[model samples]
Target chain A: AQSVSQHNHHVILSEAASLELGCNYSYGGTVNLFWYVQYPGQHLQLLLKYFSGDPLVKGIKGFEAEFIKSKFSFNLRKPSVQWSDTAEYFCALSGGGNKLTFGTGTQLKVEL
Target chain B: EAGVAQSPRYKIIEKRQSVAFWCNPISGHATLYWYQQILGQGPKLLIQFQNNGVVDDSQLPKDRFSAERLKGVDSTLKIQPAKLEDSAVYLCASSLVAGGHNEQFFGPGTRLTVL
Candidate 1:
């Protein structure tokens, strides 16, 4: 069965530290990738998405992801993290049929 | 425009009991979806509907779960004789259409605790 994977279960970093969350999917054909985030008490929202064009996609709140087709990965990255960036991040993929397969989320804690 | 809306932000029920969740999608959205998110895990799609018609329900546990979208607008998800493993947040999301590129707008999920 097709699946999405997030290897980093929990990550802790100091404020201003760089952030990288790994995401990989197991689909072979064409894919649409997305990164979603959930703050403390907020609903899950899309941070970024990649469909066809550029492999590097920039999203809201200074977030970006690189979709590497050869590696089947769409890893999310941020240059400088803030305490407010603490949240759970999820990676999702749509191979086709409008169905999304999501990865087990990674919880990031940014300490001041 | 308002986002997807769901009722009963939190619910607590005993195992073997029945519960239901209601979702009102953004006006004019043609696609609605239900997902179950367990602790420490990503949301899993349970069902999808397109304008009052079932588009996909492959992951929904048919024996215990049932969902409906009536009049191509509001939707409801129900679980009968819920099990302890059913404890999770039920999320409702909507999009303009059932397409791979459309962005899905999610609601504040209903946290269901089956004690």
Candidate 2:
């Protein structure tokens, strides 16, 4: 079965600090990767997605992810994060259909 | 446009009790999905529906869980004889298409607590 893995279970950082959350998928075939974020009391929203073409995909709120096929990794990164970035991050992958396999999730707390 | 809507945001019930959750997908969305999210974990897909037909229910525990989308617009997930391990947030999502390339819009989710 296809699965996603997020190494960071919890992360705490001061505001304006750089952020990088590791994600890896187990599938070897054609895959579509996605990063979703959920703020406290808010619904889960798409952070970014990689379907094809570009390896580096930019998403809302200055978030970007690089899809490295060789490593089976699509890591989410931000040069500088804000206090508002404190939320739970989830990495998901889809082999073909609408079904999405999600990782255990990473909880990030950005302090002011 | 309104996002996916789920009713009974929080539900608390005893083990062996039955509970149901309702979800209304976005207008014109051809695909609807239900997922389970336990605390400290990411959401897991339970079932997927395309219009009034079922697309996938591989992960669903059919013996204790069942879902229906008769009108192809709204859906309901019912858990009979729930167990303590069934406690989780039920999320409903919708997309314009059934493929993975399309973006999926999610609801606020229904949190279920089985005592």
Candidate 3:
């Protein structure tokens, strides 16, 4: 079955530091990738998505993800992190239908 | 437009009890979805509905779980004789269309604790 994997279980960084979260999927066929973020006590919100066109997609809050089809990976990145960016990040993949397979998730703690 | 709405922000039920969650999708959305989010894990799709019709429910445990989207607007997911493993946050999401590319909007979710 198709599955998503997030390598980092928890990551801690100081404000203004660079950030990268690794995500990989098992499927080899065409896929739609997404990055979702959940702040403490808030609902899950879309960070970025890759459907077609360019492989690098930028999302709200200065977040971006690179979809590497050869590696079956979509890694999320931010040039500089903020205290407000402390949240749980999830990587998800949908092959064709409305159903999505999500990764285990990564908890990012941005220190002061 | 309003985002997805889910009722009963939290629920606590003993094992073998029953529980139900309600969700109201955003207006004009044709796709509704239910997901189970366990602690420290990503959300898992439990079922999907295209309007009032079921699109996919292969992951749903049909013996104990049931969901319906009557009138193609509001939806309900029920768990009968809930088990300890059923303790998780139930999230409701909706999208403009039923395809894979459309972005999905999620609600606050209903946290269910099966004791």
Best by TM-score: 2
Off by more than 4 A, model 1: none
Two-way DockQ contest, 1 vs 3, winner = 3
TM-scores vs. true structure, each candidate: 0.98, 0.99, 0.98
TM-score of chain A of 3: 0.98
Please, what are the lDDT tens digits per residue for candidate 3 over residues A26-83? 8867899999999999999999999999999999999999999889999999999999
| lDDT (C-alpha) at residue B73 in model 1 | 97
Number of clashing residue pairs, candidate 2? 0
- DockQ (C-alpha based) per candidate is 0.84, 0.90, 0.90
Candidate 1 on B1-115: residue-level lDDT in tens? Answer: 8989998999999999999999999999999999999998899999999999999999999999999998999999999989999999999999999888888989999999999
**RMSD (Å) per prediction:** 0.7, 0.6, 0.7
Model 2, range A1-112, lDDT digits (tens) per residue? 7999999999999999999999999986799999999999999999999999999999999999999999999999999999999999999999978889999999999999
Residue B17 local lDDT, model 3? 99
Q: What's the true lDDT of residue A44 in model 1? A: 92
Candidate 1 residue lDDT tens string, A38-64 = 999999999999999999999999999
Q: Is candidate 1 or candidate 2 better by DockQ?
A: 2
Superior by TM-score: candidate 2 or candidate 3:
2
